[model samples]
Target chain A: DTAVSQTPKYLVTQMGNDKSIKCEQNLGHDTMYWYKQDSKKFLKIMFSYNNKELIINETVPNRFSPKSPDKAHLNLHINSLELGDSAVYFCASSRFRTSGNEQFFGPGTRLTVL
Target chain B: AQSVAQPEDQVNVAEGNPLTVKCTYSVSGNPYLFWYVQYPNRGLQFLLKYITGDNLVKGSYGFEAEFNKSQTSFHLKKPSALVSDSALYFCAVRAQNTGTASKLTFGTGTRLQVTL
Candidate 1:
């Protein structure tokens, strides 16, 4: 079974378009996270949720929002996507506190704005 | 204020030789360190973690890391590396932040290219 998975492996759209990426995990983990990796291969944390609670929110733009209906899934929504939003978005999950803070990630959604 | 640093942007090693990827960290209090590997087009895979046990922590795929308190470093090492082990490695640190769960700060990343 796949531990973590993301939908629409690649996305290409216009500069003013809207996009959403879905993420799910089957490791019975409670915490889910979103990360943005730039062209330089720098992976930075965007948002993190532990058991449906919004825990960490980095300096991501307000246009980008993460929604978690339950503990098993986390989805990222980007509104009015711009060229700067073109990058790979990763989804991750971890079992908080007692689980040593190790996160498992998804395949990733590569968003391209033209 | 926690941060992890993988000094080398890339590390090259001969396939049958021992390999080491350096990582250093800075945190205010006790830190929980982790090492993850990412193959091309894949998500980050958890390798090992240092949650307070022995200084030398062993993990998946014949990988291990040493936690040096004095140096504030957690470097990943392999006795004999394989060409297939060529991938991107990340070092991360987490502590008691104001978040609901402990948040991790990841290093930039280290690309390992094991050659034959």
Candidate 2:
């Protein structure tokens, strides 16, 4: 079974368009995270939610918002996507809020904005 | 602040030979280190992790990492590497002492290339 899964593996949209990437994990984890990989392939943490509490919110644009309805799901909703927002979006989950736990990641969703 | 470092942007190793991708980290206390592999257009895959145990930790794909506190490093190693092993590797660390250290900080990344 796929541990972590995301939909819309590829997305291509124009500027000013809004999109949402869905992420779900079956590992029964409590912490979920979203990472953005830029053109240079520098992956950075965008957001992390633990027990439905927003924990890590790195230096990201206000246009990007992460919504976690529950522990098993964390979805990213971008408002008015721009060219700079184009990148691969990854969703990951860990068993709990402990550094000792290994993270499980989804296949990733590639977003390309024109 | 907890930080991870990948000294080399890339590493080249001959197929059938051993390979090493260096990674160093800094934290306030005992570090929770990890090694993740990323293939083309794929999300990061957990290879191994060093919590608190033996210095040597074995992981998926026949990969192993040695955690050295003195060196502040957790370098990933593999014996008899294959061309398929060529991919981007990342080292991450979490500060065990930090109040909010559950989040992982990843390095820029180190691409490994296996030549025939």
Candidate 3:
């Protein structure tokens, strides 16, 4: 079974367009996170949610918002996407109190802005 | 604030040869360090982690890491590397005292090239 999964594996949109990426995890984890990997392969945490509560919010722009409808799901919505938004977005989950506190990541969604 | 640093941008090794990927971290208190590997067109996969216990932690695919508190380093090592082991490796860390909400800070990542 795929522990963590993301939808819309590939998305190509024009500038000023809005898009959303959905993520779900069956690991029964309490925490979910969104990360962005730039062209240079630099990975950075964008947002984190625990039990549907916003926990970690990095210095990301307001144009990007993350919503967690339930503990099992966290979705990212990008408003007025720009060329800079072209990168790979990854979703991850973990049980915070777990011994190792290791996280599992999804396949990732590649976003292209033209 | 916690942070991780992987000094090497790339490390090349031949099959049957041992390999090491260096990682260092800094945190206010103790640190929970992790190592993740990523293949082309794929997401990051958890490899190993150092929470507390033994300084040497063993992980998947014949991989292990040694945690040195004094040096603030957690380096991934493999006795014999395989060509399939070629991929991008990332090191991450999170502060210990920060609640369950603490976010992990990742390194710039090191690309490992294991050739025959």
Candidate with top TM-score is 3
lDDT of 1 at B98: 39
Over A69-103, each residue of candidate 3 has an lDDT whose tens digit, in order, gives 99999999999999999999999999977655888
Candidate achieving the largest DockQ:
3
lDDT of 2 at B19: 94
Q: Each candidate: fraction of true contacts kept?
A: 0.77, 0.60, 0.81
lDDT winner, 1 or 3: 3
**Per-residue lDDT tens digits of candidate 1, residues B1-116?**
78888999999999999999999999987788999999998888899999887999999999999999999999999999999999999999887443457678889999999999
Q: What lDDT score belongs to each candidate, Candidate 1 first?
A: 0.91, 0.91, 0.94
Tell me the deviation in Å of residue B1 in model 2. Answer: 1.7
Those runs of model 2 whose alpha carbons end farther than 4 Å from true positions after fitting are none
Range of the 10 consecutive residues with the lowest summed lDDT in candidate 2 chain B: B94-103
- Which pairs of residues collide in candidate 3? none
Per-residue C-alpha lDDT of model 1 across residues A1-114, encoded as one tens digit per residue: 989999989999999889899999999998999999998888898999988989899998899989999999999999999999999999988888664667888999999999
